[model samples]
Target chain A: MIARLRDGLAVYFCLLRGALAARMTDRADLGISMIIMLLADLVVPLTTLLVYQHGAGFTGWQRDEALLLQATFLIAKGIAFPFCFGMIWTTTELVREGTFELLLLKPRSTLLLLLGHSFQPEDTGKLLGGIALFCLALPNVTIGADADSSAALLGFAALLLLAVLTLFGFALLMTCLSFVWIGNSRLQEIFDAVSAFALYPHGIFTRSALGWLTWVIPVSVLGYLPASVLLGRPDPALPLAVGGALCFVLVVIGLWRMMLARYASAGG
Target chain B: MNRLLAAWRSTCAIAYATYQEWAAYRSHMLISLFIGPTYFLVQVVIWQALLADGGTIGGYDRTALMSYYGAVLIVSTLVFDFADWNLQMLIRSGKFLTVLLRPMSHRGFALSQKLGHRCLGLWMEALPIWLILWLVFSIRLVPASTGWFVLSLALGFLIMFLVNYCVGTLAFWLTRTAGARRLIGFLRDVCAGVFLPLALFPHELQQLLFFLPFQFITYVPVQVLLGHYELAGIRLGIPEIVGCQALMALLMWGLSELLWRLGIRRFSAAGA
Candidate 1:
């Protein structure tokens, strides 16, 4: 089992290296794309900053606290997007061309192969942006001075893992849907609108919206829950939200298999 | 007169054909029905929370701010154009040679296509979202002056297409323009006040924005819809800003034409 896992990791890195080399052929475009990705993700945070500067802020959340919350979401997105989000676009195009079967014929897991081949180096800019924002906000906001700092950090690490896993689940779900939906590009927009909620403090949402975000959709785990943990203020529903995220990931994996079985060649 | 009539008819034919081509993808536009309102709802929640203490930001109370966002949604939906992507793809794939073989100007053809696409968007995206803003959000977008708002929006549509066409022309020089396109597009949206009111920006930045053409795309139109225009501490009436929008649109048209003339000389395409 260890050997199998090592082999999978080796193949994934090999594929990722190839993607990076190909992208590096256009050095200027690569740099520009990375900058664009970072700037695109920073718009909301900038808006939040301007709001605070204008004397209007999210109630009960200080400026730095809100920034930290959003920066955590960006960091999770940064980690997920480069590693997993490419599968959706890849699936859409391959399915359109009836070329997805090439993956099934490979000796490895098709999902792993897809994930391996879909590494987007440009999206690492999101990670960099997240870290920058996180650093900028961390010093201003106190975290676990009164309580156990190490425990809060450990809790943060665990929730961030779940956050990244939930994003991976979202990518997998979208990729699976692409196999059947075929040629639809608006799937990401839907996710963007829904996930926009994850960037803000949970205090803003209505009681029912909070329930939907935490239990039904599990978006709260994507950023809010993890950031809340780091701030030494984990949500009362933290355990339940984590369970929901895990369940969400499992359901997405099942849906991926079902969709793969249903996929029929559209190419002649 | 005969020649003019022929051109008009040709434009109509092109627009109708483009309309039919996109009608099959009506589901794509319907997605906007979901995305636009959802984004507005986020804004509603954020702004509602921010202003829960009964204070104003940038000369806008809670209701005014909601109305501003509502105007942004509807105005953006009306003036949205992807001519840059279409043109860049045509250039990069060497499909532009086919356009050159035609008697009509490619710019005119693209504009006609945009007209058709936006006509479809008007019903599919803008109107529905407007209704939602009115019904669901209770943010009625009653324009301060309907005539001026329509005129400004029309100019905004022209300006949007022209600015993007200028960016698309960069494919003539760059081997990869996707990065540049995205960067420019995001900057344009930022300068145009899509994410937040330009008035919220620092005074120096707002002063600089007043001179940039991007503001003519969304900011001026939204301000026109709201019945007043002010940025960089400068204020103008609805008719005055609409006039300025027209002038900016004309300037953008000239700029696009100049770039197209220079860029087309670099086009080299062999038959596939």
Candidate 2:
């Protein structure tokens, strides 16, 4: 098992089995950790739940609708975290300690190996919390029974995957930023500062601010757009949103490859 | 008395070193300086959306709401403590040995370092952020009394530092406390009203929060700044709030010191 962990190029199942075994060795400990994270995930929604109940909610969202949006954000974050978002810190540490070069030299795909190494299985608790909240709020929300409802649900699932990919691209950018700013990198914190806006409904923001989030940072891809599909809203920009997300994924992937190539030649 | 004086002098030297260390990284710290302003901007937009029809949120009008958000940024930055993360890094890197060999307690060293770091932050981040909020958003900070405002804020710094100090000492038992610290930090941010004003919470929840020292960190100081303390029935004025905060800080310090003492025993046994 240890050897499997040391060798990232080992079979995918072998890597996952080794990780599961190690994490399962202390099941109670793992459970406690997950519970702690789940509680943390609940805090923001709980606060917002109280705030809405107290009679102040966003422009287009009441208590239940706001909960749905918050749950959407959490679900996306939870899914993205274990696979991609958490790796931002891992890559930053690697670049800082000069071991990132060693990672590049590995036989397998570097990004895949990074993902395996940085997998945070405990973050599933976040996903579970989001699902629980979504379930509680779903019935309170009305969805059209027409053919568009099925299409919107499918779109919600597909767009959810793209949203996670969009976040991965941002993480890739932050990794490159870490390389440029060797000692201290608050680039990720800037991402976080911007991401706080994602917690609220998009209608709360000005048109220009929404435009910026949609195109520049694309944070709405993480929550608002996905929730729109779930709510069966006839989004005129559905095609635009999908095309923009795909283009962003391509651009960041290209940038990540370029950065990797530069690291190969520069050696520093 | 002589030994206490010596330890005090040594801590002062450590604080000076920490201040210089942070000063050298000022440019890197600029990102954090911008976080407050960015966060306040988001709050302004959100409240604007909520109050578009010109309604109050938990008794706060639009201008009052903006000022409260601005006040929160100032206080949260002022009282921010990273002892938990710092301790985790020190322990992970095996540099905690240097701390163990010192005559003074790690809490004292960490607290002194925090003090010097925040003293710089007061000028570098907090004040400038306040000025920007005022100039850009026209969010006026109308403190009922400067004496109480400063007093509450100073006490808040001590209380938050001690809470974080207790959390940091848990590193002795846990190998990696990044997640734990982050969770605690998140709770503190929420419970302390950094995310939203505590007034916006339900009355029952707000009453429950009064018992937790987290409220003293950002909410109390902000309340004093907004003159909401008088509205909350703080009839005794500046001295009473100052005294209450000092009492909370003392209690937290005692509890944290007890934990540290016990934790160090476990740590020494583990040769960590």
Candidate No. with top DockQ: 1
Q: Name the lDDT of candidate 2.
A: 0.77
- In candidate 2 the C-alpha lDDT for residue B199 amounts to 69
| lDDT digits (tens) for residues B1-272 of candidate 1 | 99899889988999999899989888879999999999999999988898888799988888988998899999999999989998889888888888999999999999999999999999989999999999999888888888888899999999999999999999888888999999999999999999989998999999999988999999999999888899999998888888888888889989998999898888887411
Deviation from native of the Cα of residue A2 in model 1, angstroms: 2.4
What is the TM-score of each predicted model, taking all chains together? 0.98, 0.90
Q: Clashing residue pairs, candidate 1? A: none
Fraction of native A-B contacts kept, per candidate: 0.92, 0.47
Listed in order, the DockQ scores are 0.88, 0.42
Off by over 4 Å in 2: A1-13, A16-32, A145-147, A264-268, B1-8, B88-97, B172-179, B230-236, B269-272
TM-score of 1: 0.98
- Candidate 1 Cα deviation (angstroms), residue A224: 1.2
State which docking tier applies to candidate 1.
high
